[model samples]
Target: MKAIQYRKFGGPEVLEYVGLPDPEPRAGEVLIETTAIGVNFPDVRERMGVYNRAETQVGGVTLPQVGGLQVVGRVLNAGTEAHDHLVGRKVMALMSKGAYAQRAVARADMLVELEDDTDDVVMASVPCQGVTAFLALQVCTVLRPGESVLVHGAAGGVGNLAVQIAKVLGAATVIGTASSDTRRAFVLSRGADHAIAYDSPHWPESVLSITNGKGVDVILETVGGDVFDENFACLGMLGRCVVIGSTRGPGKPLAPRQLMAKAQTLTGVYLPSFFQRPDLIQRGLRFLKDGIGQGLIRPRVAATLPLSRAADAHAMLERREAQGVIVLDPRY
Candidate 1:
């Protein structure tokens, strides 16, 4: 099998594309012939040795391990928990590791069935970003009809999905922030009612202007750091701010006094932890499937690179050159 493996923790250059022995199906796991791989930020973090502060294996540093997190493929075999129905079924999985390869072994329970008509790339985009967006707006907060939403980094993978799903969840006005005119336009085309440039210093005021001086009801904040203060400023009285990611790095410490003064809520969302709550996962998966089935959740695959070009994909993401989800096809 062909896989992109990193022998050392460093930049994109460390990710080497080479041949490797096929991974075997472990007990309670399924061996998948990967069709599509979702290139995510965590992959970059893992490659750069920032995912978890753990000791690395000497030399090869787990040579067979790959960096991708999500994959869409056909299940070839299951090692345990016999389910004849799963064999050869088209499915999408959220694997903990090893997705940047022609074959991936994922826990059977982590894989979800896909409709025949569902594009592999689209399903590949769903598991990680989809789950987070869905949980933040609907499952966790329960966005009400006529409520307003603002999604930071709204043109990126999770942000774009948040923009589209906010409307489906009954948000009356959806505002999204992107870095450029092209990205702002893309966010608006994805169903957001308002689009603001993230680089503009007064973007928060612009949100206020669009909302008629009242702030938005909900805010999906992924870009943290200096801009986090502005995000809190844009939250309406009695509004909810969901912190999803801190791509801009850690922001200033939260002040409890501010929340108390405005009677607002600040919530932190991590999808991996949400898995322990099966109810949330079940409801979220249903919402994801329905959204994809209804054409409400469209995929923005700006580029599909081969597994060998994994380094280029990382460079594109780190440089902020890609508009939407950058995917990798192992078959490519």
Candidate 2:
């Protein structure tokens, strides 16, 4: 089998497309002939040696690592027990590592069966970003109908999905933040009632005016740093803020005293930790399936590049130049 392997942690240059022996499934795992690999922020962090949740508890990553985070493929074989029924089935799998290859092993329980009509590349984007966006609005905050919403970085993968989900949940006013005019338009097209530039000096003020000085009822914040500070300030009384990611750097301190004054709720959403709950994972999958079937949510594949171009994909993502969700086609 051929895959991209990284011997050391650094830039995209560390990734080398090379040949490797196909790995067999362990107990409760399935070996998949890869269809598509979902490219995500964690994959980039792993390549830079900065994503090490396992380092403190388990151990640092092993060398010559394969770094894709989500895998969509057909089950070639299932190891042990009831999993045998999974053979020959198409699946969307969530993995911690080793998906940037033609063949990868996936935990049997972590996968959801895909319908024959499902677009393999699109479903490939669902496990990671799709689920994160779904839970962020519905589960994390429990956004209510007639409530207002403010989504930061609303033109990116999770942001785009969050915009749609907010609308589906009946958010009365959905305001999205992007860095440029093109992205702002993209956000509005996806269902945001309004789109503003996050870089604007008075976005929070803008939101206040949009909501008729009442402020918003819920906020979706993924970008950190001062952006978090500004967005948190926009929350209405008794409003909630869901922190998804801090790619910009840890935002301003969350002072309880500050929260007490506004009666606002501050919460964080991390997919890896949340995925540990089997109930939540399965529920999220059901929501995704129903959403796609109803035409309520459609994961976009912004760019489809072959696995050999994984390095280029990483670079484009790092530069924030890619639109929608970027995926890797291993068969290419």
Candidate 2 regions with alpha-carbon error over 4 angstroms: 52-60
RMSD of each: 3.1, 2.2
Among the numbered candidates, top TM-score falls to 2
Residue range 68-146, candidate 1, lDDT tens digits: 8789999888887685579889888876688999999887767778876779887786777888888899766778988
Number of clashes in every candidate structure?
0, 0
The candidate scoring highest on lDDT is 2
- Model 2, 1-332: lDDT tens per residue? 98999999999999999999999999988999999998987788878887556542323577879988788889999888679889988888887788999999988877788887878888887778877887888788798899999998888888998888888888899999998899899998898999999888888999999999999999988889989888766889999999988669885676788888779888877777765675677667777777877899877777999999999999998997888668998976
lDDT of 1 at 224: 89
